[model samples]
Target chain A: MSNKKIGCGCLGCSIPLLTFIILLVIILPLSIFGVMNGAFGSKGIPAPKVELPAEVIFHIGVFPVTNTIITSWITVALLILMALLVTRKPKLIPGRLQSAVEAIIEWMYNFCKDVAGEVKGRKFFPVVTTIFLFVLINALLNLVPGYGTWPITNYAGHEVILLRGANTDINTAAALAVIAFIFIEFWGFKFNGLGYLKKFFTVERAFKGWGKVFHGKLSGFGDVLFGAIDTIVGLLELLLEFVRLLSFTFRLFGNMTGGEILILILFFLLGFAGFGFVQVGYIFEMLVGVVQALIFAGLTLVFATMASEHHGEEEH
Target chain B: MNIFDKLAELGFSWPTLVAQIVNFIVLLVMLYFFAYKPVMKMLDQRAQKIKDSLDETQKIKDQAAVAEQDFKKRLEVASKEGQEVIARAMRSGEEARQRAQQEAKVEAQAVVEKARQEIQHERDEAIGELRQEFADLTIVAAEKVITKSLNKNDHQKLIEQVLAESTTLNKKA
Candidate 1:
């Protein structure tokens, strides 16, 4: 509540603050090299590298595969198994685990309803719930050891290798974003009929204003020429419709890739020399996963809300 | 991979669209039955049962309260009846005592009156005898005064006095 500290009361603000603290705690000591005892932690090791989740490891169709991929796959399987347990034979008196899960489901249900309204809430619950589960599963996998196994020949040539979060790869984040973006427009069209296409025409009305200018007070030849310029401006507005799709897809892709690259680059700089510095990257990556998930879901809720609004003139 | 991709990239695939559509609908139906419907039903049933239980509890408490009031009312009526009986008994006993006292007072008065009558009768007898003695003395005095002048007229006066005295004695006996 105090204004003296920079913690504004919004839930999102705590995220960056957590990131700051995590980075400070991990990297600050590592940058000083011998600031603390090097015997413990990743300092003595050549590279302070860690593993990723299982599902992403299995989804690895890329070169230079690592144990991190295996971790990502395990994360996905664990997520499904968790869902099965949570859903099967729910009791009136919930077990602690069941109670915790139900509390989360209820929170999402209410949140969706508030942001998207009742009809849209019903439509969006499934997608949002799936997104939440997927993100959580990936986050959990990082804790698992040797997640999904793959044999890679090292520089010394004895096979040994990898694990990682699936989202750390651009392919996974892009896949999720594409799925979300496609669904957003899909739901929009489903709810709004053919009129969903009319979003492109929102800016085209400027041409009508231009036409009126020449017809009414601006009837002179010069006014007609000016009206033509205004009509061209409306045409430019038509061009921007396609740009919305690019913005939607790229914004998500860029943020996720940036977070992943930021982690990799941090580790590359410090390797084993700056062991703790790499953990700062993982902490950042973790926060990024949470943010990306929230933003993806939040956008879905907002778009669904907007698309479902009454679009036409009301009849009295 | 290229040939397959090229075929798809070059032209539209009806089967893919149909399959995706089917998958989406199936997903919706599967999730609706398995997850959504059960959750909603559970919530509703829980709410209903809570309300019904509260209603039942209230009804039972009301019944208990009514029974308690009935028991209290009966106790008060029983106590009131007992007090009334005691008061009536006291009133009856008082009346009986007052009647007995009144009869005794009347009987005592009658006995006293009878004794008074006996005493008056004795007194009258004694007074009668004294009067008779006095009359005898008066007769002897008359005889001494008039011994020579004892004629028919003196004799007649003595005889009438003696007759009057004899009648008064018979009345006293």
Candidate 2:
């Protein structure tokens, strides 16, 4: 009831998290029930799907914006209003909301410090922190219900759901990953010239042609053999870059798709998962999605940091 | 081109795609306005506060260190002053002891001098009595021979001896 967050521990992180949890309680059941009511694919066990009584039957208007869209807008508006009300004017000595915000800031600062050194930390903050926030808010937004219903009607007079989990959409995840990869590569190229590619290729120091190479005995045979080895290593480096890109794209896609499918399957395919109020795995699904996004962001930083780092020492 | 036209005939319109893009863009913008700005501001402020707190903690530690050093300095000074006080007390004690010893020596000399004076007075008194007795004896002898009365003279001389002995005893007491 008080402005203060209920629990003493991690009250900062926990309060916003609790709000999301409450939202889940409302939207999760409603959407699942909606889906079970033949809005989505179905299994056998049939409850008389408690159809959300026509909340002014999805938009009859020509435009996409309607009741469902309005709700989405409200959700967005609520998020904005809360932020403004909590933050806006900074206090020298903070109240509860300020303290909660500060906790997140400290967490992020430490995260940046640990992953990227201070200089890279500052540079990466804009992108990395932005990604973190984007994924998080989107995840929360996906928890919102009445999306398909409130705006546009399906053929059976149901609300047409327009918006969904942005990351859950393959297009969104793939796009984000690709953009992040491109940015990382850009930073790499900016820092290290064309021959930075050589660092990955050419397993020069590791095999070392039996250490006589260190003795500077560049015999003709040694040169030829090492050159072949270098060429192969260079090919491997090129292969590895492709692999990095694929994995980056694949990882984000897999996690988000899995989370979305899991939730959908839970409601329509496996009703037992959402039976009663024991639909907790949905939250876990949300958590998994968040972790996936974080992993993606973290990988970007790692690649960026490594690419920008001094290359010569990496060989040794 | 005929197949594309047929698909278009099936009602896929560029306007819809544009509208969807517009919808997406609007959503993104709305999200940015709603969530991103506040979150970022919150984050920035929080970060600054944490840094400030850490700096404050460092300042407190510095002050504590200074205070500790000052306390140690004061203790050292107090210890030095304590030693000086002890040394002064010991020196004064020694001087008082010497003064008391000197006073005792003077008192002993005075006692000795008074005893010596008493002994000299007693010796003088005894010598004066002895000299007077000798003169009286000579005078008694001359009277006995001149008058030719031996018994009366003997009696007078005996009485005189008794009187001299009594006065000498009184002086000794």
Candidate 3:
């Protein structure tokens, strides 16, 4: 077959092919050298340090601002800017940006509605969507290049990176966990009123059992036993609610830090070989980021729904 | 170990947490006003517009159907009226033709009756003249046969009486 029949046989095809060949030729030796250097420990490149704490970039009054806070601000600015840009003049017949913005919001709205009933979903939508977007954008933006590269000398005369992943910082995670906790409890109280406290306090069952026991009914001992168990269970439930804050904070912080470290280690190990392979870690991190964001947001939604439910009403 | 010290070891600062919380609240508020509310409103508005337009289209379709029915009804009425007019015109034409025929027949019969009367009158006058000529001729023949002069008035009376008797005899036969 003629070249024209076989392929495009044009400069466009040849140019990319030549570029690929050249890149392969260059990359092959470089990869081998990188592998050799990594194996032999030639001290050519130092291993990257894994820092758990976010470096304080500056201070406002007594409050020491960290790099993660800066990143969070950047995330907030980016999100707000995008929101404003897309929704400046919303049209019935939307443009591309408007359509994308609407699709995301609508998807989140429908998700909330699906999980919670319509009335409760409307109440939960803002906080749930905010948490999802905040976590998601913060995680995704952390993967962008130059986040950990820009070093600046602080007022304390210590060198620290200017920006870090917001989720990597314990303080930010803790803040989000605190917010989620507060909102969950708030919604619980709002929906179920003072009866919400009954979820954690089972004095009524025990009180009834005590009253029966005082009336000289021997079978009331069974009720008393069960009531004590119920009270303990309620106490445990209360403890679990507090424990959720710690879990929520650490889950995000651990995953984000581990992802960052994992990518760093991969880059250090493979050196030039990391060119193609490190992308795998990045892809993994991206998936982890999306999953973690979803988990954080989804858990908060589930917890809030559980909290708002009238537990005592179901038994009656 | 102090719990605060332990928390500090893990890089959890109260000020930073508070700042972050404040930041998040700011973000949430901003996003609510800028993104969620407008987008949700726009979506609802679009849905409403679609529903309204669909309803309008259905209404217009229904109106078109009603108009078509009305037009068909009117067309049927007009056609029925046209047929009735045609039938009425035909009836009037038939009556006019019958009336003209009856008048023509009467006129033709009148003309025939007048012609028959005129023919009878002419025949009677001609018979009277023929009878008068015959009388004159008989008189002249009697004068020739006698070959002498006689009273004219007496001969005339005798001839008239003879003629009257012969006419009566003809009538009897």
Give the best candidate by DockQ.
3
Best by lDDT: 3
Alpha-carbon RMSD, each predicted model: 11.7, 12.2, 6.1
Q: Pick the candidate with the highest TM-score.
A: 3
> For candidate 3, lDDT tens digit of each residue in B117-146?
999899778777766776676668666745
For candidate 1, write residues A99-176 as lDDT tens digits. Answer: 776676677778898898877897888777656555555554543343223345554455454554544433344344
Could you tell me how far off, in angstroms, the CA of residue B123 lies in candidate 2 after the best superposition?
5.3
TM-scores, chain B, all models: 0.46, 0.62, 0.68
Query: Chain A only: TM-score of every candidate?
Result: 0.62, 0.62, 0.90
Segments in model 1 whose C-alpha atoms lie over 4 Å from true places: A1-73, A143-161, A202-287, A314-316, B1-37, B47-173
Model 1: per-residue lDDT, tens digit, B37-75? 555455556668889989999999999999999999999
Q: State the lDDT at A272 in candidate 1.
A: 52
Query: Best to worst by lDDT, what's the order?
Result: 3, 2, 1
* Model 1 TM-score (2 dp): 0.57
Candidates 2 and 3, the one with greater TM-score: 3
**Clash tally, candidates in order:** 28, 9, 0
The DockQ of each candidate is 0.09, 0.05, 0.63
Per candidate, native contacts kept equal 0.01, 0.08, 0.89
Task: Give per-residue CA lDDT, model 2, range A1-316, as digits (tens).
Answer: 3424555665544668867776777767766675556433343433333222112223345543323233334444554455566557756567897667556545665677788788777666555654565556556666666432224555457654455454443334444555566667777777777657666566554355546566776654476586677778778866776678667645665665565555555555445434543356567866875787578767777877877776775445
